[model samples]
Target: MTNVLQVIPARQGRAVRLQAGQAIRIVNTHGTQVVDTWCFNAADMGEFMSMEHLHATLGSIFPVRGEPLFTNRRRPILILEEDTSPGRHDTVIAACDVHRYALLGCRDYHDNCTDNLHAALRQIGLRSDECPSPLNLWMNIPVAPDGRITWGEPLSKPGDAVVLRAVMDCVVAMSACPQDMIPINGADCRPVEAHYEVLT
Candidate 1:
């Protein structure tokens, strides 16, 4: 039996420590929800997962099973073990921040992925500045033939999940992506509950 470590709610964030050989399973409880994820070396905060490195290493935008998520230091941090969704996750988009909201014409304070990531990292004695761009799980932002990217609803179904195993001791942070302005979350902006499990 696997032990349940933490369960993160929609629009919220969580940070957990995973040792090498351990895995964290992220479940899309309601489907169509995007999970923004970040990883960092536990011993050295400066070394964290890098999307640019991953793309250069894999030569593809999407992650495949059995591939390692490379960090800025050119080290493997996590390995993609399993994915049940439609494999539409993204790596190009940056987490939403206050400036983004302002550009969208939102005057009031809005809950965003960047802030959520910072909050989660704070629990581990880290700050927002240390947070890096994340692996957008279940997100669908497809590039057109003209090289324009289009945001669309996620292809993940209810109960869809992805399991990633840590290759080294690291801190894993996640945000349920509270992007309400787009169809990424069904255009309702209502966040759903996301289930997380750390398996030994």
Candidate 2:
């Protein structure tokens, strides 16, 4: 079968399985979306991609293309093989959740990346006991010299893409972040859809 472009609907999420040596190209289709991305070892759900470990391994908060995304065990789970944007993906922030929205003055239940991640996993008949800190694809958070960090709009343009190759059998989950309370998705704070394709 052809490798078709799959849509991660606006304010929703998706998950896919990949074998070692396979890759997934995630696209910022509209340029205004922040996709919260996570990876889990297919053989062991407890071994998932970890942002804290990633920061320690990369020695930076921003992941560079061609570097491996490390798991909590300090093992490489996926390699960021190719990136078409300016490479400003954030690793410092936690995935947004309902509590975050509540803190933002949202009185009603709000769609969030944390919920999206779990829902996506369930769609594929899998479940995770915890939500790991995701690689905030295209989500820009600028750090200051004094150690303050501020949310910034993404510098990536429409059609920008990143290809992540699996180092071991794994499952990748992505949530098209629904962060309308803030402008992290864009200056307008409008979240939108993204696309991805699995490569053999």
Give the best candidate by TM-score: 2
Q: Each candidate: what lDDT?
A: 0.88, 0.95
Q: Estimate, for each residue in 98-196, the C-alpha lDDT of model 1 and write its tens digit.
A: 889899999999888899998998987876455577999998998998989998888999999889999999989999888888898866756776889
> RMSD to the native, candidate 2?
0.9
Candidate 2 whole-model C-alpha lDDT, 0 to 1? 0.95
Indicate the worst ten consecutive residues by lDDT in candidate 1: 124-133
TM-score of each: 0.96, 0.98
- Residue-level lDDT of model 2, residues 49-112, one tens digit each, is 9999988888988888889999999999999999999999998889999999999999999999
> Considering summed lDDT, which 10 consecutive residues are worst modelled in model 2?
1-10
Candidate 1 — which pairs collide? none
- Candidate 1 CA-lDDT value: 0.88
- Number of clashes found in candidate 1: 0
